[model samples]
Target chain A: MINPQGLMIVLSGPSGVGKGTVRKAIFDHPDTEFEYSISMTTRNMREGEVDGVDYFFKSKKEFEQLIADDKFIEYAQYVDNYYGTPVDYCIETINDGRDIFLEIEVEGAKQVREKFPNALFIFLAPPTLGHLEDRLIGRGTESDDIIKNRIETAKKELEMMSLYDYVVINDEVDAARQTIQSIVTAEHHNRKRIEQQLRKHLLEVD
Target chain B: MINPQGLMIVLSGPSGVGKGTVRKAIFDHPDTEFEYSISMTTRNMREGEVDGVDYFFKSKKEFEQLIADDKFIEYAQYVDNYYGTPVDYCIETINDGRDIFLEIEVEGAKQVREKFPNALFIFLAPPTLGHLEDRLIGRGTESDDIIKNRIETAKKELEMMSLYDYVVINDEVDAARQTIQSIVTAEHHNRKRIEQQLRKHLLEVD
Candidate 1:
């Protein structure tokens, strides 16, 4: 029998929905076994950020070369900086029977879907749209106009919730983390996903 | 917004696959919140079995009337004794926002599928056909011919496993129980199932 591949879990949601916080909590939990797929970026590394741990720092020329070679599952240009998920690492990790976790933006998630259609897509949602707006406003660093613009973007992102396989309401970080963990566990037991392996085992017995 | 309905979980598997044992363990656990759907039957009450608790003992006439009235979700006759699951209790419990759990034979589960197409069906499978055969033979009380017949039936039932949403290997009772619990927890967070309610909430916020 062939070796079973690991699952690709993509965690994404509207901005200000605490996707990063919930993701941090999930990875911090002792039980998390998924290999995090560190994103690559051409942007300058900020103070105290590790070269490979926080983000894979790449030169603009190197990043453009990777895009040309189709080495990224998804890539986007923002303010003249290229950011993307490298495809080779994700495929290699999954083929090695280790689940790969990707915390990315909605557009990146859509690109991942096109490349890995069977990957698990989980949308982290706010308890309500009002809750999302409050969180956006609660961040004191942003001006009122910036907050309003962020709220508009959030509303549009929430509409894309339909694209996700599961929605973990980020009302509480721990609760969302647990839900995501359980989803991965349950997905492993899904008949559609594991049937072929079991069928081969049964035929051998026969 | 309309109140959300609870999920209907159907646990079924081949004969002697320990469906009853696992169901008992699930109910015995303090964390199980699903309402058990006690089957109605026309079979004579055993010395220790109590009506309503063990079974909803009904007269042959009442059983026939129920069949005619379509009151049962599924029913079958064995050795002139009628046994079945009632439809009303399941509907009432789900409508009350409480999950209802049904443990039944594969045939009864198929019948339930025709009615509750969206119900979560978990097929409890043996670890292997060899393991299943050893279990059947280990019973010791059954004659060789009876055991042979049971093995044939089990094979056919196993074929129907593709009809289920999830397949759980009954390798260990406790392990299977935990997987099942996780499946239910993850299912509650499924985007397709809860999207409507969240959509309504979002619309109200807008």
Candidate 2:
């Protein structure tokens, strides 16, 4: 068990598992003090995407510089997009008494897990495989071939669920969100800290 | 992580660290399905102790009778009192989808750990050795001799904390409770189940 004040939460899942949606719900939860991490990427941002918010879009040189300095906690080159979590930003946020939440893919999640052993890793899953396919098909941007690829990729992702700390099924959005909230709330109460606080209180009480 | 629902939870702490208080708070939490095992004792019950609640309050004959019948889950003689948790009750409760909570001494906890590898063993503690003495003395129930012995015993208990799957420090009641709740909740999102569920969902969808 650990503290309630600050945590590095990694939420990972497949392409169509509604991970982003669940994260949104957690972010909007009342009195929640968690902050979303900004991924540093070499990819160009589309219109309306702000730097340091949507993502800290970086030039190839800057991304390489950060990597050289070990400023990026975990970075990967995927299909020309140099994407990684900024290390210092998350550490700073946690030190400020606020948790940093990361929404990353399975590979990225594994990398974060290695670095942050105690960080909470939550695996979000689609309610049903059919639902996952429906979501993919419903997206007008993708062709049938692309949708098929995504579904296949999701299957591979499923194989890795056992690697995470928690596997949360997104069958019911509200229930899943509640599960996330409660889990986050509970992590703060782990054994060592609780003992410290209680011992302190017991001694101070009288 | 694996329903963690049907798992056994072994709770152990030094005497006067208020393991009972923490256990009580855990049982009182809503949506928590747990059966706090009632220990059977060969010793006579003290005043205000309820049968089948605080303990089974068995006579030596009854206790031996149960032992002969193989009714106890894990039993041992401690400080002249023959104490044991009814194995039948724990099995029944766990099979019923409720987690079993056993508040036992460190020795008994080890037995539970050995018997049930999936069982979650949590050690409760105070922040430091100095604080432990304060809590024990604050209770005002033990003689000076007894208090000293307890302090010595508490050190042994602290040493065993590292063996436990998790440790909880009873620094403050509510905060400790929150941490435990989170660990349990987060654990419930077992990676195996998600993988299994995802694979099953994928098959259906395909």
Best by DockQ: 1
TM-scores for all candidates: the values are 0.90, 0.82
lDDT of each: 0.85, 0.75
Compared with the true structure, what per-residue lDDT tens digits does model 1 show for residues A1-206? 22279999999987778876787898899999999998898877756668887689999999999999989999877436777899989999999998999988788899888878899999988877888888878755567877777778888888998899998889899989988999999998899998888867764554
- Candidate 2 residue-wise lDDT, B34-84, digit = tens: 678988887766567688887888888888999899887688876567888
Give the lowest summed-lDDT range of ten residues in model 2 chain B. B192-201
In candidate 1, clashing pairs total 0
True-contact fraction in model 1 equals 0.67
Model 1 Cα lDDT, one tens digit per residue, B12-100: 98877878678888989998999999988887775666888768999999999999999999987743678799999999999999899
CAPRI-wise, candidate 1 is medium
Q: Per-residue alpha-carbon lDDT of model 2 for A1-206, expressed as tens digits?
A: 23434788888888778876787777778856689987888977756667887678899998999899988778887545788898887898988778788977787888888888878888887766788898878756568987888888888887778778677878787788878876666555454434554434434423
Which regions in candidate 2 have their CA more than 4 angstroms from the true location?
A1-7, A41-51, A57-71, A76-82, A94-98, A114-119, A139-141, A181-206, B1-5, B43-47, B192-198, B201-203
**Could you tell me the TM-score of chain B in model 2?**
0.85
Q: What TM-score would you give candidate 2 relative to the actual structure?
A: 0.82
